[model samples]
Target: MMGGSAYENVGKKWDLGVEEQEWFHGLLPRVEAERLLIEDGDFLIDDDNSILEMVNQYCLSGRPWLDNSDIVLKNPIFREKWLLQNDDIILDRKLGKGYFGDVNKGIYKPMGNAVAVKTCKETFTQEQTKTLLTEGRILKQYAHPNIVRLIGIAAQRQPVLIVMEFVEGGDLLNHLKKQQKPFTSQQLIKMCDDIASGMAYLESKNCVHKELAARNCLVGNGLVVKVSDFGLSRDKVVHTMSDKNKPIPWKWSAPEVLLNGK
Candidate 1:
């Protein structure tokens, strides 16, 4: 058996001391640990009995032989993206409104860039608040050109805001309907390709976009399409239905999903 300070906690409970540290991410998968190590020298301890560190161009682990068989880290995780000050966001006109809250076209002062600021309703329940924040947490893990990027969240005050990239052309469904000229075959193909690419990335991350539809996607400049609105997205590869009363877009759902509610 491999023995020493390295293999001591293989099957035992995770060390309490390790759990108390902010860098300690208990029981995280190899892919996830690498995702978090975005910057050079960035490191985190996981329950795999190893310390995974990013070294500019290589992902080296304390026990390389045990878990360095696949994948490489490039983009570093930014934890500061989670919390934001209310003062940094300047809310403008409303872009859209939904059941949970309003998404305003705002300016995030730090970056001085246009952003879609999503705010939850004041009457939100505890469960509703959790779901709103959960969406932010899920979106943080995703980084792709075909996927809408999350800027940050301003949750320091009453109206918690979720700041995201403001796609110029707006929602795909609306964009398609409002087009003065019909999209050419090439344009249509490009849009489909963009959506497929984003979905493929989500699949690789073992995530399911429960509500994948034109309405949930956004059109950016140059007619580029990006998958957006991940409030209904799940992290699991296979999700079984449990909430029978939950509302879903029946028209956009797959046959299997419509029949089995999965």
Candidate 2:
């Protein structure tokens, strides 16, 4: 937790007025905010003023702001706190590649644990970088055993990396297709249940996974399945597509989403 002196310095550095400080305190209870502030090794209270302004506005409106649009737009601060030093991660082997990035198996020096490091293409446009950061922000907010957990992001360097828990069993589709032995109906039912439970949790949080398929799900030891990929997920029920929106994979997308482009 931040010391009283450090808290006072933050208020002074941001030039927060009495009411603004009170509102900021209310938005993130002092204890919780302080704990996060102290835990983050690269904490920089001066990096983003827009986040402070957004929090102040939400506090004035007397509404919860953590999951709101305003907060989402100004999520750099959240991403900053979770930023991992690139030097600390050692990339081992390529896991897979996607349109935006490639995933690699790696070792996180700090925790001495295996992790997946997803690196964006070096030629990514500014908008693509923002989208990648947005995914990092979303993962930071949602933490569940059934969902792939984001460890941190290595954004200070090129080909920005998103580190996450590594699932040894790999994706579900391949796991099913390459079964060494025939599985019982009960095992298949349990896998379905795991997917449904994860989706149910997302629904309760007012989040849409957008992409839900066997290929996007990962399996762990003891056949634990976890939902992965949040590049297209949204916190709201309806998402507005841009003119440059990529064509949906019809096989994995909902009929209405494909028809109406929601």
Candidate 3:
């Protein structure tokens, strides 16, 4: 579900603090302009203001802006070759192509904070665009340490980048196969229990994680488990794109999403 763009959130309601409301009221007319804007970590109403801050701090090294001509993105000192750019550091790896975009390991900078960034393609159908936006919002809301936290997002017409905490230990599928050592029943039980603990948190928030395969989980040293990838996660949003325009990503999604909850 796509909530109305922050642009359209003016008349409905706001979860903003009182001070935030004052800031919002200062630009009442701008919000009503029907244009979407996010600047300086704070959203703006109009696009005419060109000096928007690079709030998407988690960019490819330094190349943060899109450059279609060069087939790269340029920031201050870096030039990300598109594939190398992710919210988390790509660490110069080639993961694979994904439904919404591609997957790559990215450097989460400042040391001790490696992250994996999900880079999505820019060209999207009306439905795909809606899915992308909603997917990002849900990612930002998940607060558990076991869940990959969304750092930030960079959006353009064709390429969108989602920065998230990178799990260095890799996912469960690779770990399971790479380490092929048989685990005792107790170990498996502990693994399952850890997963349930994480899911239980998501459930307490009235959320459901429909996709729970071995591949989605990540295991670090000391057997710490964290879940990654939520491309199919959904919840109620104020429906920005009409149902007629909403398109669902079904490759990894089940039949229910394709049918829009029947």
Q: Of models 1 and 2, which has the larger lDDT? A: 1
Q: lDDT values of the candidates?
A: 0.70, 0.68, 0.52
Report the lDDT tens digits of candidate 1 across residue range 1-262.
2223222233333353443333444433354566666654355554434433232114323333336453433232332545566677899999999656998999989888899989988788756765676677678888999999998765544556788999999999999999999999999999999999998998898777777889999999998999998776666543466689988887766455677666
Which pairs clash in the backbone of model 1?
38-75, 38-76
RMSD (Cα, Å) for all candidates, in order, is 11.4, 10.7, 14.2
Clashing pairs in 2: none
The most accurate candidate by lDDT is 1
Number of the top TM-score candidate: 2
Every model's TM-score: 0.67, 0.69, 0.58
Put down candidate 3 lDDT per residue, 152-232, tens digits, no spaces.
Answer: 554422355666776777788888889768877987787788788887777676555546667888887677788777764
Sorted on lDDT, best first, the list reads: 1, 2, 3
Badly placed stretches (over 4 Å) of model 3 are 1-91, 108-113, 156-158, 236-262
List residue ranges in candidate 1 displaced over 4 A: 1-79, 237-242, 254-262
Residues 94-200, model 2: lDDT tens digits: 99986578889999999999999888888998678767766776688777888999998776556678899999999999999999998899898888888888888
TM-score of 2: 0.69
